[model samples]
Target: MNESKEFLKEYDDSKYKKPSATVDMIILTAVDVETKARSVPDKVLRVLLIKRKGDPLVVDITDPYKGKWALPGGFVNYYEDLDAAAIRELREETNISDVYMEQLYTWGKVYRDLRRRVISTSYMALVDSSKLNIKAGDDAEDACWFDVKITLLEEVKTQIKAGYIRKTTYELSLVNSENEIKDTVIVTKKLEGRTSKIDLEYVNNPSGLAFDHATIIFYALERLKNKVEYTDIAFSLMPEMFTLTELKKLYEVITGKVIYSRNFRDKMEKQKKMVIETDEWESGKPYKPARLFRFNPDWVEDQ
Candidate 1:
């Protein structure tokens, strides 16, 4: 043990370079948008973004991407934990806290940052927007929730020797509260059977989300879609009491696909422990009132 301690003491700490660590937050919520009917609103999935006040790559005064929008995040402090850093950054940048968030993925690409090597551990969060008060702080010039829409543009598969390559392109659009298009990001992802792996790269991003955030947002959306089918994650974005139709709409909006009413109802019925019928009905609607239900707190432990 003494020899080991002596060797450790003599070892040089600067022999290897370390990459800076950061935490990027993907804060998602469902907001009610006014449709033709003012009583019944349409639920839309929205993501929170912050406009950078300065260039992240350098201290250059005239950087074009300085004012670009990106995820709320910052460099992790040396003495802070990763999860703690995520929560801290989210609160500091957007004044959002006490939401359900989990580590989604770690992104480390050599060219991801132009200034220095940075490895980001991203977290995904789900919250009911009506419950929180948000304000822009820290290095954020502005912050707002943008409605998210994703469209599949093209897909092609090519056969190669002993393998195949699949390429897919998608377009992501962010709409502001005034019902106008804020920005659009185009992404191309390639899946190669030779390496049994998938890779994503940006094709065109007019929104100018800093770094590889466009890909990160796309990844978080895919993760949410997959998890909603099996996990109770959808409940986080729901109100305390909601109708079955409202629940179905939430699922459809997140998945970006139409679900059969009969099928969805049957599935939810099977999970009897998940929701409980409440002696309540929705009000202020154009049509007849529908019975309301609430998520069962007892089943949360099992979920």
Candidate 2:
């Protein structure tokens, strides 16, 4: 140990340039957006975003994306762990903590950040927005949950020797009705095989999100959609006790599909055993109250 310490003392520290590291959080939730008509409300997927503050020092001819909306994040401290940085950034930006979060991907494209070479590690977080009190943190001008809608615009598949290569293009839209803010991002995904190399790119970014956040958001959404099919990760976006209808709506929002009630319940309860019956039922509805259920903690995906 003493010999190692002596070697470290003589080692050069600045032999190679190190890229700045940042942690971006893709915090998602489900909420009932207000509508014009008085009727049963359906929940939609929303993502928490921070409005970047215009810094006079940083804003110049080279940096024109100062005031645009971006994923909630900040530079990681040199001593902080990646996961710890993600949790800290989430808590600092949205006043949120203790939610389901997992590392998604690492983006290190050169020129992704114009100011400097920055490598960002992204984390996906799921929360039940109804239960949390959210507010913008200090580093941001404002924070809001924008309703998320992703539409597949085009797709192509080609046969290859090893496997098929599929390329899909999507339009990602985020709208905050109350704030009158809307951002649109176009991204394309390429998969070489069933489990081979995967690539993501931003085809068009009109609103100009900070860094390569639009691509990161697109990747996280894809991961969420795929995970919900086989995992109980959706429960992180649900309340402790919820109706099957509510759960169905959340699933529909995430997967962007219409799921039949009977099949959804049968698959979730009987087939997958992902939920357990609760002693409560939804109240004060015009129709018959539906039975409430809670997530089954011990449920594992069938291999």
Candidate 3:
């Protein structure tokens, strides 16, 4: 121990250059898009984005994506943990805290950041949209929630000796009606054997999302879609109390599929035991009042 301590003291810390670490947050929510006053609302997924403040980096004289939108993120402090840095950056950029976030992925592509070498670890969080009181941080010019829609443009599959390769292309659209911001991002996913990769370019980003955020958003959306099928993660985007219809709608929106109401209710209530019934019913609807239920966190254990 004494010899190791002496070696630690004599070790040179700056012998090699290291990449700066940062954290980006993909904050998502489910929103009810209103049409006519009496029409039933349409449910859609929404993602939070911030407009860059155009501040020059210490190593650069100008910002590459100044005044454009991006995921809420910043450099990680020297003494902070990765998770802590994600939470802090989320709060600072969007005035959002008290959210449950999961580590999505780490991006370490060279030249991803123009100014300096940066490695970003992304985190994804789902929240009830009604609870947000968003404000732009010092590094951001504005904060907004854009309705998200991802559409499959094309797909192809090829058989290989070892395994099959599937390639799918998707168009991700973000629209903020109130802000009049419409952004389009195109991404492609290539699945070779057991591995898959997402690719995007600056030219593919029509609305100027900073760095490789469109790819991160695409990855997070795919994760959400897969997890919502088997896990109870979708409940994070829902309110404390919701009707069976509302729950089904939220699931359909996230998965981009049409779910039969009867089958969905049966599976959620009987097989999964994901929700518990309450005596309370929905009010002020043109149709019959629906019973409200709350999520049962112990469903997995109970099963």
Q: All candidates' lDDT scores?
A: 0.81, 0.81, 0.83
lDDT tens digits, residue span 1-303, model 3: 999999999999899898899999999988887866754576889899999876434333356777778899999999999999988888888899888899999999898888789999999989887878999986889999998877777778777665665666667777886644333445545566678776654334535477888778888998999998888998888888999888898988988899998999998999899999999998898767889999997888446
User: Distance (Å) between predicted and true CA of 107, model 1?
Assistant: 0.1
Which structure among the candidates has the greatest TM-score? 1
TM-score, predicted candidate 2 vs. hidden true structure: 0.86
Question: Which runs of model 1 end up more than 4 angstroms from their true locations?
Answer: 38-40, 55-64, 178-195, 204-207, 271-273, 298-303
Question: Model 2, 164: alpha-carbon shift in Å?
Answer: 6.3
Using lDDT as the measure, which candidate wins? 3
Off by over 4 Å in 2: 33-40, 55-63, 157-166, 178-195, 204-206
- Clash number for each model: 0, 0, 0
Task: Give the lowest summed-lDDT range of ten residues in model 2.
Answer: 180-189
The residue-level lDDT of candidate 1 at 152 comes to: 86
Cand. 3 Cα-lDDT: 0.83
Which portions of model 3 miss their true places by more than 4 Å?
35-39, 55-62, 159-161, 178-206
The C-alpha RMSD of each candidate to the native structure, in angstroms, is: 3.1, 3.2, 3.2
Sequence-dependent TM-score of model 3: 0.87
The better candidate by lDDT, 2 or 3, is 3
Model 1 accuracy (lDDT, Cα): 0.81
